[model samples]
Target: MTISTNSLMSLREYFSNQQILICFNGPISTNLIGEIGSALKEHIESNHAPELEVMDVFSVYIEMSQNIRNYATSHGFSDSESSATVVIAAAEAGHYAVCAGNLVEMGDGQALLERIHELAACDKAQLKLLYKQQLRQPHTQTPGQGAGLGLIEIARRSSQPMEASLDPLEPGRAFFSLRAII
Candidate 1:
């Protein structure tokens, strides 16, 4: 098998057209998350993004990446199942879009997508209330189960409603993707 140069160039051109600043697709470890987070921070800063915006982007990226890592680990997924795709891109009017996806059990992905849709339908004040309510809830001891406050926090920080989808793969599994614009 031979790799086509034109195909590689087209891939690069696609990213450039989409204004994707950073993209990673593979198994993600804790250390890799930190490294990518650092690069993301530097990239945003160098672009003269406001301090708050930078923090929000970094925070959301960490939360999303960590959730994928923890979920994969808790479910005892193999490396292939554990692989994740993350992208940070420039959006309209100086906003940045942080998107991530990973493989998940079909049921789990559907449940998560439902929750995200609920959050997306909420107004800012409603989200703030939900955030506080989630904060007051007791934390779960399960590895992949937290108070679920991260989702609320991400919603609160987003300039627009968060978006999510679950694409069916083979039986019992799907690809779960989320997008948060800030």
Candidate 2:
């Protein structure tokens, strides 16, 4: 499906019976994450949905947002530059999906794809173990930015395997998109 960029700009798009799109931009700050998290929690609760589902959304949202924050710092993606956007939208499948796209060095795309492919193949049990292992590893963050544990946590929580793509932007930069459904 052709997902329009504008569809992700407003949370209203995700509020209906089948979907809700929660989108954010730029460098992620703690305050912004809290606000976004609260808004999503309130959105789910306002619908009178089960607390379980709301918690699911909350957990997934935190992971996705943190990914964006890390990407900004790791890849030098700035919010004002229009090179990064993070979106969390609920779908008809009864799952909430998180998607983040940002600019990165073209050289990193291949390695990122390889990492995503590895995570996608891992089962939940394996993902949980990986999350714990990665968490314990000293945060050897790369040059620009990254916390490094977000993906393992995402894989652990997502109902399905994580999905990602690297699209070319410029000669030296590419757009990386990652999605997970919970």
Candidate 3:
């Protein structure tokens, strides 16, 4: 399909208004993760972002991207369903918004939303405590089979509570999006 010049310009305007530095929509793979992640790091560093902030933003991007990939692989999702949309944009107060969305089982999406809400309710101290508690528990060594530590790690790095949304796409399926402010 050919994209018209007007539509392309509109997208450019929209991205400019949003201060979006990077946007991707496609099937995510490990190699793709590294390539995009490298680009993100370079972009952030070029803007003279603080060293710590750059690391935090990059870390969150990797964790979210990996989570989407692993979940899709483990769940045996089709290529179309496994495709991911990731956006990283500049926010107020020198903060960065790292957001990712992918199709998920309806039940899984609802459960994830609930989990995010629970984490959002916790204060920094509580989150720290929970992170420690999670560490002491037995966890699988594999990617997707872990003890849910990745989300906690992302939460810890976030300057504010993470936000998530689940939009129904079809029966027994929904598009789940997660945003972490770092």
- Structural RMSD, model 3: 1.4
* Estimated TM-score for each candidate: 0.96, 0.76, 0.96
Local distance difference test values of all predictions, in order: 0.93, 0.73, 0.92
The lDDT of model 3 is 0.92
- Per-residue lDDT tens digits of candidate 2, residues 148-173? 47667767778889899999877887
Task: For candidate 1, write residues 31-105 as lDDT tens digits.
Answer: 999999999999999989889999999999999999999999999999989999999999999999999999999
Which residue pairs come into collision in candidate 3?
none
lDDT of 3 by residue, 1-182 (tens): 78899999999999999999999999999999999999999999999988999999999999999999999999898888889999999998989999999998898899889989999888889989999999898777664562177888888999999999999988999999999999
**Model 2: how large is the Cα RMSD against the reference?**
4.9
* TM-score between candidate 3 and the true structure: 0.96
Which residue ranges in model 1 land beyond 4 Å of their true spot?
none
Better of 1 and 3 by TM-score: 1
Measured on C-alpha atoms, candidate 1 has an lDDT of 0.93
Clashing pairs in 1: none
In candidate 3 the C-alpha lDDT for residue 50 amounts to 88
